[model samples]
Target: MENRPLIGITTYLERARWGVWEQSAALLPAAYPALVQAAGGLAVLLPPDDPGRAPSVAARLDGLVVAGGPDIAPDRYGAEPHPRTAATAPERDAWESALIRAAAAARLPLLGVCRGMQLLNVVRGGTLVQHLPEAVGHQGHCPTPGVFTRHPVRPVPGTALAALLPEAELAVPTYHHQAVDRLGSGLRVCARAADGTVEALEGDGPGFLLGVQWHPERDGDLRVVRALVAAAGG
Candidate 1:
């Protein structure tokens, strides 16, 4: 672990029910840290906090992972909330948005998963589809509760994702009702679902900035995490 980079993972502040407890807590799936460690990096949980502290935090981290969670407030991107959109977490949105900005400013490597990807897009002047089924016809993008729908996505050749997965098609674990609609500023689409939903994208800047609609960590897909840690080392 000598050269292990310190990677900060953003968490969700939400209500949970556990053994004799039901209250709001900062939570993140264990898969995130485990995958990061498996990729040879020190994992740190970054719960949403004061916005003013984000830049300093980004300056100290080797990399950042915007973990997946609740829906973004539609108003953040100048849209009305869809009925299917979950309750908004404005504070979390504000904090994570700040983190994204700081990471970009510092040119820190970052990976955004699920809701994380949506927020990253919105924060960068991009828009979201809000509900994928309405636009894509199939709920295969998010088939069932507590289960990940598997689907093939084609990566654009010569993209960072293509380097990791050279196959023409990659089967990914995904569970999301929303997808990226408008392309974000300086962001390039790296992959797309069979139905044409954007599956992954990367920023045009110099550092590693990837956002995927799939849950790579949940199923031990290490390519993306490994790439991020490698970039952090550089």
Candidate 2:
């Protein structure tokens, strides 16, 4: 439907050691696509290969959704890799970073989830906490595998994130360890965890750029997706 907004979902590129293995890795949960569809938006998968073509790819889209994936390379934010840092996909870093910048410049509505949130921060001149367990001294973020636990997020009133889920206390699914350390320029913190970790951020200027550390898609929070689509004005 032309009346409906088009949301571009970013894809991850898995690289093998021996040769260049170009393939579509399922970085986002199935719930993401379902949520977008339910929110009256058409979701398109944007791969990390050849991001120079993002302008052309984004030209047809109304919004952009940066999905979660592997840990980002510390170098992108001016830090050294911790021993606990997982495998860093440089190609993914290069492509997604460029894509985020382009999407921001185009004034497209953007939503970043989990690792997507981290990427959004980095793209805006921010940095990450490298290792949550080492820095935060707690493993509460991710308790077990294949299971999600709800956590309280205090959203700053009058923010896009707050307007989407207007509750005194919002319970969201948690699946990330690292979080925003130094906020990016012109971005404001919109939410935080009990441990003082930055949970949500939005663009300071008059555009839709919201990033959440939780997986709203996994928790079936269609309101957030709907708000993003609405901002797209399709």
For candidate 2, which ten residues in a row score worst on lDDT? 15-24
Shift in Å, residue 97, candidate 1: 0.3
State the lDDT of candidate 2 residue by residue for 91-144, as single tens digits.
778877887888877888899988888999998889999778777788878767
Give residue 205's lDDT in candidate 2 (0 to 100). 89
**lDDT per residue as tens, model 1, 158-206:** 8877887799998889899999999889899999998999999998767
Q: What is candidate 1's TM-score against the reference?
A: 0.96
Q: What is candidate 1's CA lDDT for residue 103?
A: 94
